[model samples]
Target chain A: MPAVAFTVVIALLANADIAFGQPPGGRPRPNLPPIPPKGDTTHTLTRDFVPASNTKSETAPHDNGFIQRWLALEPIRKEIQRNNILTETYIRTAFAENNFSTDFNVVPKNGRKVKVGDQRLQWHALDSKTFIFNLYNFTYAINKPPYGNIFWLVTVINCPEEIPNVRMAAGVNSGGMFWLNGEEALVLSGDRDMVVDNVVSQPLTLKKGKNIVRAAIINGPGMCTFAVRFLDENGSPVKNFTISYE
Target chain B: MKPTILTSLSILVMLATQTSAQIGQPFIHDPSTIVECDGKYYTFGTGGGGLISEDGWKWHGGAVRPGGGAAPDAMKIGDRYLVAYGATGGSSNHKGAIFTMWNKTLDPNSPDFKYSEPILVATSDGYEECDAIDPGLMLDPTTGKLWMSYGTYFGYSRMVELDPKTGGLAPGAEPVDVAIACEATAPAYHDGWYYLFATHGSCCDGPNSTYNIVVGRSKNVTGPFIDNVGRSMLEGGGKLVAATEGRLIGPGHFGRIIVEPGIEKMSLHYEADLDQGGRSVLAIRPLLWKNGWPVAGENIKAGTYVIQSERRGYALELAVDMVRMPVARWFNRSTDEPIKPVDTQKLEDVIGDWPSGNIDARIGDYMSRPHQKWNITPAPDSSGYLGAPYYKIVIEGTNRALAATADGKVITVPEFTGAPEQLWMIDQLTDGTYRIMPKQVPNSNEKLALISFGDSTPALGKFDVNSDNSKWSFRAP
Candidate 1:
């Protein structure tokens, strides 16, 4: 091993199996090692990272545990996307009034019914997952989110091992709601920054294989994207995972 | 007094202001016409008010505009400033009315700050095919008439002519359909080609917005503006100007600032900057004309760079004999040991090996050698060509500088003298390559073109028009 790799190993050993946030089943919390406050840029780039603390940050207050590739869906709400006659303020107002529960986690299993924006949707056999929704609008303009509007994308994660007492680490911009295995997980509403590992979810169970992850992302007429990864109980990345699109 | 953080910060801010006049502060949306009245620059935005810049940078909001609407355009018409905007348009307000007013001066402190009452120019009474919003103004150079283009994504984008003297509608002027398929249609005249620029795709969604500026040009100001590919603006045919790919997205409402003749910059509102919490902020980029069409270029930033020749991507270096530095390997070096910093090859180690004469320029494989790097610093006080500051390109960490010679050759001088030959003008081409031209050579009127003189030799000659051999790209090691 090179000196850089050796130093990284030593740092990992020094931080191994440390107990994190409280969770059921005594599983360690899935969280990231805290970085020093924003000013010390030099030290922050070093391998010996300090553990996280609950420092109040207006942009990224909380740290996410894991960040990995995810799939997204084409945006819905044709009424809003039509020449933008429905207007972004109208969709933003509806999202502000907390009216997006109807869009989250439409269908985890293939052939399940999901109702969204006066339309009933179900997972088709051809539905697939993508790496990210960063270019969903341009890549899928047919049903992509138009300017000044809102849309939803849901992804399914298939984990090999059951990740007990784990937290869903996500970086979401412009606010969104998350669901796991058809259960409501967290709601990050309001116009917020999408800092990496920005939000940590409450204790959740990632069963062996085929876990449904759904997101109803809302943008007030700008860029909207979400990054997510699974964290194991021991403040580390959960390995052996793939995603599904059905 | 000892230098503290506050004092050092103050010095940094002062230095920054003197270097770049049109950057580094004031995030705004839908900015109005940027005009220099006295020594200060002023612009009105949406939301009824405006911002004032004392030194062309570091803006603060104190000025005001009438109508309190969105996407306002202000023009200096003779002795007064003509301002136009949409009154009730908010994406889908077809009932919105176009309004205009006049003010003598933009400064609120000026005695001539009073604005005339808002006069209705046009209106879309909620039932028309177009929603009257997002207006842009232009003064026809040939006809000396004022024209405004206004509409929304609701339907047709239309243009109407006005009398320049009174800012009133011209006789027999009706709304003529100019462009469709986009919003924020702005008209401009350049070299007999009347250009129409419009913002395409989604806006207001922060990072998700995909706003880009597209353009079409015409020989006449009014009808049938066409793109380079011969697509009409009325038929959704537009050539792209600025689009998303980098950190900023949804650039809309094109504004032009003329920095002397042949030099210009374009201003627009990026719907969301991913780094700035998705807030709509102002952005100004270098606007250069290529093939008779205006294209945006990158802002020059101070940095160290590995100047690479565009043809073969070989790095530029001092024409000196190569001495391979010995690489030492320690048998006892263990992986468990902490890493130590290694000293980079210094200039002194190679300076003695170089010929004691005028050093020429060459292209070679990058070896992180001291001769392969250059430092580019913005020379703002000294004037160069249009719309850009002259730059001083010096050998990294050394006094040896690159200069263009009278005989169409490049040589490294011992020190920078701020001479015309030592000043380099860099402009980015539409394909993102930078063409660097020296200020002047003894009797030549062309730029320094870097070309291959055999296999590995890089020689300089007069620039060949639209030649790839003349462009270079910078890669930082």
Candidate 2:
């Protein structure tokens, strides 16, 4: 009877580990370098973002053309210089050499685990209720240090019809790179605050089908955030499309 | 009209000017035009935070504005709200930047509530002639173009165009000098004329502030705005719109709110409400347009008045059998005898004659009868609309209350139950006449005003500003 009770307890513990996407023994910790202490802790993490109320796990762009839904992978520790030495050359070279994923076009499933460098990170589906995504809050929410890390976000936009002459408008803090359908579309490399439509890509066409948008945001110190949207030739928001974490 | 009754109404008006202000914590400076969102009203002031009201009358502070700036203006465009404010400027330094942002919802608790990062639209260096503060936003109803007027007493007031879609500066749009010697400038359009409303004189001086609202009109949004007498606003010519009234001194920052077609209200702040400890407080008054120019209208005060229909020179009265007065046999009496004043018809003399049920109302000759005398008093415990409280129109000395029936008719009920149908909104129209509307019509959301359907008939109907049938005047009996 004591042996049977011990077996039952073992089964329950195994089920709990499986529920958290961990192996039976335990999840492996990321074998990454130690993270330095955060420089600033005075930032009032305003609970501005809320979970999207989409029942079908899909969302839409904001009325002002801001994309608010994304599937984010857990941050991977990275060495970054202070004083915003993050320039165009530094960011492009960093993103080019690091193979974060096997295929950029593939939209990772939420709760799925991925191995980047020596770190094993899980993917999460998040809906930013605000125009700008607060990366500090996002990292803190996932129990990870917000600074000195790289965050990878992916979203699938389903267009109703083929759209022409639409430009990708984006703003990001620190530095970031954007990809559309596995092709580099825009790169924002600077230490700056997020301003709406701060950098707009040249006019591009959106095919009448699912389009994958992926981004990698790198922050060395201070706050990190990003917002992206599509504007038509007339500069109005392209809101006819739907967003989902597929 | 009796001289004594006129004197009473005059006193009431004087008292209202000194006492009637927005209730609750309505303290604000340079309040923007009040905007309604999801049935709630919000108005942002000069500082950062603003006031929100479930009902327009009672205001308290819970509104949120991200950028702490001076003179913010808010407007709703499509499904989004655009907010523009000046970032910096004061008596010492005039260097400032005006920014615009978009928000999904003004209520902070809303799931979609978030403001787009503010984009700088206009700026001014201290060395420049103009200060880029005091941003007043106006969307041209005709062209769908958003325009902003900004500046201060430090330099020229200027107008610029903004992208209505992005809340950014319009492509290559330059600021055009519109007016000088004024700040807190706002633009309004009426009857094909674009009017530039601005605050003139000193501000932030409490009771001693010389601030007054003045305006000039032009045919174009990019205007050489001209006053009524053909003086250009660029030359500092502005027709006076509002000035110091009673204890509320320094009326500045004019914001116009159209309650309905014929009813409008102007929102401003009294630099010092002596009654409110000389603190700047929000005040809303009826906006009356006279001779193609806008002027501040008085809020109707609580008093006994004879409601006369403008359609016909007849009075609103209960449709009851006329009671006979005591016969003095004056035909045989001589003029030489000492005369005693004839007391007015008392409510007791005729209320017993009226049916205990609802009495239909009509327009008839007013003989100062008790039924024709309406005692309009602010209904207690009622959250009022916009600028004034909902009033209870009752017989002078009884509970017979004026109410709107489910059917499109006006009647006097036996008692004032404080029901929505019994509450009345008496708005002073632009023509100085009044349109009496119920707080709500029974079984319908349609807003109907008391109209003289015929010379002898009174009914609830659509308010037509051009027709005298929709107008009623409150006269002293």
Candidate 3:
């Protein structure tokens, strides 16, 4: 009976590895361009992001209603058009074909690997100290050019009770698309600069338990950053919820 | 004998160290005129940064300016902010260039924050008569034209016309020499006169800097500014506008802030603040007008005073029953009788008849009564307004505080609770009289000042500067 139980556990572990599209023992190296040297002292990068550790508890949104925690994937190289030509139709057509798996229901764990075309990318859980997450500094820290890249981010919000008439308010540099609970919530597509409350989603409900939020941001040839939070029906910040990476 | 001398010396030193400058980290040199933006106040300084204040009282440094320069001035033109600065000469060399730029917002965190490229408005060669620095901007309210005044002590202060739309030198404009022997010059418009306020004497000497602000006025925008004594500023003559006061010394770089119709304030930097380790610090004082000329007013010192209403020459007092003194029969009082001093009405004598609860306030004839004397002191743990700290006005030797009610009535609560309604903002108006306003009225946000409704009635109402009802005076009891 013990031998049978051990076999069942091994089978479950192997199934999980296969589901994440990762090898059992090690991650595969993808063919990519060479990284540039680090920036000079004039480009002082803010130390706002830190690796999400298990010992830390859940985080709360900022007083001004800004979310600052997410599980972000490394940049994926994409040959996108210039900012002026990036219209809603063009972005929708470019994003119609899936670059990776669309099964966002499963929360990606930290250090978990996934395959996008021939490239192997890993998820990084980070807690941002600032309201606006600086994607330029994040890419530059890893010796990669911060322009003309795409990034995916996800977060879990736990509500005490069912909340209705809540909207997602976001500001993004370049363009972005957001999804809540596996449903399309907001799409901000333009060659636009970051402005507070630039785009707000339609009113939606948050279930009593956990709700997942996923987003994809595309940038081209400029400083890349984004900020997001939830607002109530009366346009006030909805801060009575905890955020975590599930 | 030695101990007494030491004690006297310590008290003198302590008195010399007491200052009434703007609170918080208000350290800045050559500050521009304060401008209000998006519910906050900003003032840029000489270097490449400035200060921001949420309440106009406690200031800290967070303001952002791009170009590295000396003596920058900021103004809000329409929906955009225009900043002018001198890029080079503040030292031995006289060659410098003055540039101007525009920004949608002063807040660095805003997405609309981006400064337009600097436009060179004016310049000076090394041998020119004027060193192009310390630029001050004024958008003419009469003709709708923009003008800039820039120069230094190297030669003559000059004025030039600028295209308000582009923030550049106006077409076919030339520099016109306005004044001599003055730097950090700014232009102001009040009534029908155009005033040229400038700084004179030596600066940067800290404790020994002889810097003082002087002014001259003219009917036109350019040339022939005259002082009060019929002396032209071109001949090195200027009427003294502001000088050293209390622990603050060497006032320079005059800037004006019109808070309302009658309340005005002047902003400048003291070359040395003895209480602040001789650092250059920003100072804001009440701007009073005497005989149609600008003069710096005094900040009220904490003391006991008889609150007199300018409307009817009556004093603000508790509405309790009047207590009389012992009467002396006057039938036989005559001729060669030795004079004896009759004591004034004391608080102890009146306490027995007064009620120990909330009492209404009234304006009555002044007789130096105990209830008419108010002990005005700075409220502890209270944030201030623009110029000075909020004060708590209580009856002398009692905790009965002067407060405002929800129904626009003035009253005195038995004990001072340090509530918002109990704090008062006593501002010395431009006419040398004062306007007493409560920090907040109960159940309302409308700022109401203490007014003389009638001869014997004290109420809170909208302050009208022209009416005598809104004016008050404080006299030593």
Best by TM-score: 3
Better of 1 and 3 by TM-score: 3
Candidate 1 per-residue lDDT, tens place, B200-301, comes to 665544455556788899887787988876757764557888987477877888877765444476778776666755555666667778888888777557
Score each candidate by Cα lDDT: 0.60, 0.75, 0.75
Per-residue C-alpha lDDT of model 3 across residues A83-189, encoded as one tens digit per residue: 43456786666555534557766589888988776778878788777677667667755656656778888899889999999999887766888889999888888
CAPRI accuracy category, model 2 = incorrect
In candidate 1, stretches whose alpha carbon ends up further than 4 angstroms from where it belongs are A1-246, B1-25, B306-348, B351-372, B377-394, B397-477
- Best-matching candidate per DockQ: 1
Give the TM-score of each candidate: 0.50, 0.61, 0.62
Model 3 residue B324 CA deviation in Å: 1.9
lDDT of 3 at B341: 82
C-alpha RMSD over true interface residues, each candidate: 25.0, 30.0, 32.7
- For candidate 2, what's the RMSD? 26.6
Q: What is the C-alpha lDDT profile of model 2 across A23-107, one tens digit per residue?
A: 1233221111222322333333224345433346667788777888888888988876331456789887777666567477998
